[model samples]
Target: MATFQIEGGHQLKGEIRPQGAKNEALQILCAVLMTDEKVYIDNIPNIRDVNKLIEILSNLGVKIQKLGQGSFSFKSDALYLDYLESEKFKEEGSSLRGSIMIVGALLGRFGKGYIPRPGGDKIGRRRLDTHFGGFIKLGAKFRYNKEERFYGVEAPNGLKGVDMLLEEASVTGTANILMAAVLAKGKTSIYNAACEPYIQQLCKMLNSMGAKIKGIGSNLLHIEGVEKLSGCKHTVLPDMIEIGSWIGLAAMTKSELTIKDVSWKDLGIIPETFRKLGITVEKVGDDIHIPEHKSGYEVTSFIDGSIMNISDAPWPGFTPDLLSIILVVATQARGSVLIHQKMFESRLFFVDKLIDMGAKIILCDPHRATVIGHDFESQLKATTMSSPDIRAGISLLIAALSAKGVSTIHNIEQIDRGYEDIDGRLRAIGAKITRFD
Candidate 1:
């Protein structure tokens, strides 16, 4: 296990660039399996989960090459299909939730896919029904090996597209089904699909690879089956979640930081959502400039003078991933705000760590929290803690950075799973953090 030792109450300066989107990279990396031609990808994040998925692909005989920093080339012409049934694959595949996506691409190009029960952050019940259900709707037979806790989907005659309405706009589910539908026999229409930027990027990448897809930024998607797909080069967008984290970090520590090349147009509701807590999110070209909150920030009340409430919704709404960061930032604001995490049940449980650090927070339930800011009247006293998940881990790191003393965080591998070289990046910007392996 790795740990982070951070000295708090220090103002960090200088600019930092957000890494490539982790969620998008997971989906896009799986999509590479849909073609036998060489596919080039740029801006890949050097993270744990993404690297695990890449290793899984390489084990399946995909010819992978490192072109440069954050760039790679992949060719899946000679895949080792038998490897999918191996015990080594089961161990590797089960370790990453993103590995579920490879099943769709495999089923599309090879007619069958099998996987061990995937694992990821234990935030809540993350069901795999959406992914398998979508596959079943598209003419694949589903089977489960309860003894082994494994899942398999197969279509001997290949998948045939059909019109279906998704139960929820699950992002990974939508990506998986969309990848399968691209090589299906007929037109597939998916309604109530996730329209997040990650999904949009995947759709565009598939289109470039000769797959017919429409509805780039909407809930409904239409994909026409093609004989086969060709290779295409793609670049991932900067991670919006990381950008939002930096915004919260700048405010809580009263630091003036410039987040470079943030892709403002794609950051729907993120900037405005931070502004609701009275944090200044300025637009300077493609960058986000967050000035020092020297006097502290105040939470804006509702028009009816009711208490402020912030919640997560589907695309174009506030992202649930950043709600943890928002809750941490609200701890030092001038007023109170309610954070409702509608998507996950257990994300709010990490508030206890903040409570231990002297922040005033009411854990109303598993899904909601009410934060009462300290307004800088009292500083958080740092202490030892353990990271729970990727989002919560980053949230705790932010709280530690703004605290009054040294803090030790265990299980930092959870943090490394998403953020690329986080401690090094923070150190570049004057953050007092050290990593011990």
Candidate 2:
């Protein structure tokens, strides 16, 4: 197995370009199937999950040509509907959860869709009910093969757009439903939809492809169904999760790092969120400069002096994906904060590893963690550990970078699935992390 041998206590100083958005790439790549014409996509992150999805699309007969680095031209004119029912497709689909979007596209174009039980991070029960439930609400016949663990959706009469109020503001669910509704028979209004940057990007791209979608940043989206969608060129935004990771890494290790070309206007409330933790983030043109902390980096309490609390919610709130990074950053801060991860149930379990590194944290429950900071007085003692999920894996890597002594993190494939060239990028910034067996 591959592992990362990180030598901590070294300060990183340099500018690093954040990768293209991985989450958006997943949705966009799947959206390429919405058209039979040549669809050109630039700024695609060449990571494991996206590569796997590309592999799946190739097996289904999509003609994909590498236009250049981080760019691809896809033509779905030769798409094979029968390939989705094959055993090989099932094996590939089970590797990543984002593969489920393929089903929505297939159902839209061919009146049928098939997928195996999708696989992703083991953070919690990421139920697919929201996705399939929306499909059923759209007049599709749904069936689950319990013995073979397969899901099938068929709209033999063709899909008719209907108003859907999703149970939760699920990101992928909203994307899947929106993709399906783009070519439906009528208008589809989605209430409580996920308005994440990725979702908004997907909507804009869809509209460029001839789909009429309203309400760009709001929770309610109105999609006017079209007979067919055409090809369009789309460039993905910078990875917000990666931007947040760099912010936490800069603070945790007391380094000065500049995240380049982050598309400042799109990063809603992310910069201010870090400033609340006493990290000095300066905006130079369009880049984010995080300078090294020279004094006490304390958590700013609420106006009434209550212990600061950071929690995850839908869009416009702190993302749940970066809560682990926040937890690690808080370990070296000057004050306490309660991290409430309300979205995922088991994401906060990684705090045990942080406590073992000498950070003070309390596992209030599966959803909440109270972290008491030491203001860099107590250093983290590094040891070997395994990465649980993609976000948590990077968070641990950041913690290991700041800990004293040599730390080894196994199962780094989880980290590589999302981050593009992470070790190489860190090395450019003077981070002492190497991938080894």
Winning candidate number (TM-score): 1
lDDT of 1: 0.96
Model 2, span 1-437: residue lDDT tens: 78999999999999999989999999999999999998999999989999999999999999999989899999999878888889998889988999999878888877889999999998988999989998888889999999889999999999999998999999999999988888889989999999999999999999999999999899999988899999999999999899999999999999999999999988888888888888898999999999888785889999999999999988888888888888889999999999999989999998888888999999999999999998999899999999999999999999999999999999999999999999999999999998996
Q: Compared to the true structure, candidate 2 yields what TM-score?
A: 0.99
Q: Which tens-of-lDDT digit does each residue in 80-143 have in candidate 1?
A: 9999989999999998999999999999999999999999998999998989999999999999
**Which one is best on lDDT?**
1
The residue pairs in collision within model 2 are none
Scanning candidate 2 in windows of ten residues, the lowest lDDT window is 290-299
The lDDT, on a scale of 0 to 1, for candidate 2 is 0.92
In angstroms, the error of model 1 at 206 is: 0.4
Q: Candidate 2: where are CA atoms >4 Å away?
A: none
